[model samples]
Target: MAESTTQRTAGSAPKVQLSCEMCRQRKVKCDKLSPCTNCQRLGAVCIPVERARLPRGRFRKSKAAHRVPESDSADATDELKGRMERLEGLICTLMQDNGAAANTIVPAMADAGILPSPCNTESRSDLPWPVGNDVRDGGGLVAQKPSAYLGNSFWEGLMHVQNRPLRNLTDQRHDGATFAPYDILVHGLTGRALLSPLCSTTEPWATPQLQQHLCHVFLSQVDPVFKILHQPSLRAFLIEGKPYLHYDAHRPAPEALRCAVYYTAACSITEDQWPPAIGASRASIIARYQRETEAALVRAEFVTSDDLTVLQAFVLSLIGARSQDRSRRAWTMLSMAVRVAQALSLHVPDPPFLITAFEQEMRRRLWGAIGLLDVQASLDRASEPMILRSWLELHAPLNVSDDDIPFGHEIVPAESDSFTDSTFTLMISKAQCAVRSLTEPGSQYMHIRQACVADFQQTASQLLRNCQPDAVPFHWYTLQVADYIAASMQLIALRPLQRTPDFTPPHVSGSNLLRLSVDILQKTETLHSDPRGHPWRWFEGIFVPWHALAVAIAELCGCEDAALIERYWDTVEGAFERFGGLVADEKEGMLWKPMERLMGRARAKRDTLRVVFTPESASAQSQSPFLPVMTPDQNQHQRGMGLAITPCSSTSGSIGVEPWANVPTVWDEVDFGDVGIDQLSWTNYQDFMEDMQR
Candidate 1:
């Protein structure tokens, strides 16, 4: 195909004119080349926007001039081959210069079937992420239905536009000349890429002996916190080996299970527990295991399959999430697990025929556990529970042991009711009820919040009533700790009722809240002081009691009542000492930053009021106030949320511009001390509504 001789002679031969579309859109002058000046300056695509200027009445006088001469018509075909070659050469150069841009353009060339184009022809093959697909029918490693693409006319028009560059000095089109094509095609096509391979990096699979050992340790140590998996099935699966594999396309991958086991096991290990000759300490080893677990999950193709292992892995992943600083990622991952369980209708009883009674029971247990997690996550992050409150049909797990059901058994009938899970569900329902009723309250929430005190305590007491001497150590530990957790949760749930603007003299005022917090803390302290209490220091998330302690100390320091402050000061001091002591041995600042800051504030309080202590009280403590902790800083870069106040001087971590940040927010004096954050964030409030609606 030849360019029209008249058109070329009128524009290119004499003097170029007209600005490119890109320049016009950008409101700039264009050099008007195929790859024009403004596009070059901006590294953008340039296509000419045809001007509709007909030269006014110039057309009437130029009717003869518009006609092509015989010489130009005859010679038009002579330059056709040369022009075609030049155009082809320019295209090839652009393609090479912008190989990545070819990916965006390539989709237009071939169909989705042609993904990971044969033309990726680069020497490198190992890409960290997947490349886009190319045209193909159904036969391929992974099928792509198709892709949306701009037409060939659009591409051709963009790459090569009419209207030559104006050469006139006064013409704005004659400005600059350069062009660059930058492609974010990878990001655009990222949706189609399977991320499983990216999650492929994993630790070596553990030996059978190690796997068994870890499984035993995990069951004994971690299962009580989130009992999502069936112990009997897990034990048989680990011990009986080949019998456990699912005969289906979506069988649970061992790698994901391995991750779940290893991650749980990480919680139990300590520096002293690690074997000698291991250069790294316990924390490093645990972190390595966590990374491996994530990698294995990615490789397991968890998202595409309805595998039970993946759901359990997500639960374990959530346990690990609390260690992360203010991360919401776990909430998102937990939502996926909730969705998967709901999809399988674990919320309802398992269907009659497709699965055995054992599997049916297992599903029920997992579903209930998932609910507990969903509720907690929602409460912690101040998000609505993912499980639609009204649709929940989930029931309690059977109160039986793994030993109750031997391998190859269809199902084990419950001999007695297990209050552990059943009561847990009831209390969770109550807690959820407390949460929902509190959100943007009505008169009804008042009655409900008032009842939380008795309801939470009664339910908590019942939940712990099933323990026997012969029961597993971890099981007993979980029940005991749960009693404490429920007490703390009650305090959290009732906190909002302390501040009802519409109602006078709320159920729990600042004084009562302080008393309740101290009560919970004292109970936690007692349970913690017992022989098994050593593990309380190591427990993560809900079991940690940071909220209870934070409120207690804040109230203790800010309290106006001399009697309350005097009476609770020692407990507040003791709690602070315990937390501070825990973090003091670390090479790093602390395991959790919020704890560190809380401890710091506590010390500041003691220091600020050291003189107020009586001689008798002073004799029981150090004569001088605790020295103010100076946050070390090279440039004082340490910064994040959670701390209500911190040292000023953005460049300095120690000392402050003001005595306090915004003003000392005293507990009980402020709404936080009254209602707590859960009520404010609408998490605990949602739970209240869920409970009542139930």
Candidate 2:
């Protein structure tokens, strides 16, 4: 017993190791592997103890068994994504709120358009953001400013404005080149307007016939495509006086909306477009209507009153000038509307209790139109779309003509067929909103793969197939024209990336791209304001991209395949003829002038293209007087695309010169001209490179 006790004492020593079950059972020497050598030798079943599986009387960690439910995991992931998107949007708002004074790192960063959809979004987290919607906390900016917040989206946006300049603070040129677009973009976002002297008008706003003419001009001419100002109700207000034309302490008849209509109509043509009863020079009439509108805005407090009519009036006024080179002002004008729209929660879907479905529909129309304006105003930019889809729960306006939906028509009791019929119209608007992300020509928003591109193409085709041009020519054509432009731009994007829209790792076939380009050009037919008469309107939309067309055509004209060139040759000539038609619209005044000037440049470019893209061109190019200009490095980082070589007007620089200087403008050098490397055709690419070598 004394000997056994001594052995137990020795066994209980500090260095004692646990024995394997097989060894312990066999009472033999064993190593601590799962199957001890002794078990293998005995050919017995060996069960090794696992400390991890062993039950502990004490000192075990209190972790619950981790069998995560699929639903729970999915919910967590979705919640996290929602938080991230919200945080991103908040940061974007703060960037705008912080303004030039706060983000001294790059003060003049362009607030290039971003925003939310059809009235209101049920899910704010899913909303796509436009880069420009900076109208300071829902237009209460007059009362307060956006608080500063920092994040990837905000700083990334600021850091990546197309052709933005960055340099040592010590550099003199940096201030001029880098911040030029920034100053312009943020100018209107600041709470207070500088208050300009109100210009006066001479048009007869009280004249019933004149109001009739102007309203007709908007609906017949503009509304089919734009659809901003509600047509049926607006018409009823004029003809039947149903909605009560309410205005504040001003010349009762000369309210903001009326002035806007007058201005837009007057600007739409020279004095000849109107009858003798509405006699006024186009220039003088434009001045008068503009004056009345501005004066009314100054006195008519839309913000304090929270009247959407005033906001609508204000938007209409801006729309009158939408065709102008107001890229800078566009940022402010639309952003102001956005703030008010948000203040009214127009981006959120309305409950039937809060607003009738009709009202909700109208609000959605206004918001969607505003979102489009916000994008177009940014000079046809795809990055930082102003409105997000998630922020709006507003459905698309019914596809039915205005005649179908009377004033205050309720949706709940409506025929389901009418609602179902309007699917195409809704689809078109979705495409328009998606343009900001879809038309991205650079790597800035490339995560959007080919599937999105395919959907856009399919939708465009479907819209075209279902549209009745005779029923609503302007509206139908508007959708048609926009789709064609998107197709053209997509073709451009597909070219340089070589692979499909999905960014698959392969080069796109040049021939498929060529065929697509020719097809887009063929669809780009010109239409006049009157089908067979005077007052010719260019087939222009906010998204009507003349430059992209020009680039695509230039590439096509230079194609190596003789058969393809001959096939699409007339299409190219036709595009030019149509573009040249704008010059005849000299009577349209300043609104048409920017495009007119672009056409003039296109004419010059045409001479170059004829030589470069046609069969009889190589020798001509050798003798060409217009030499290509080259930058030391043709790039600056536009956000996620870090220092990529942008061939669009050479967005790069050398020493002492402002790194961002001489970057083209919408009115000047190039308007939103980043079409990716795809815009550069192989021939043009080679030629441009050769020039660089020279």
Best by TM-score: 1
How many clashes (backbone N, Cα, C below 3 Å) per candidate? 30, 42
Best by lDDT: 1
lDDT of 2 by residue, 595-652 (tens): 3343354346555545546545443334211222123332331121111111122221
Q: Using alpha carbons, what is the TM-score of model 1? A: 0.54
lDDT of 1: 0.47
RMSD list, candidates in order? 17.0, 23.6
lDDT of 1 by residue, 106-180 (tens): 655435543333454342232222222322111011213322443343345334532333233324334555332
What's the TM-score of every candidate structure? 0.54, 0.50
Q: lDDT per prediction?
A: 0.47, 0.46
Cα TM-score of candidate 2: 0.50
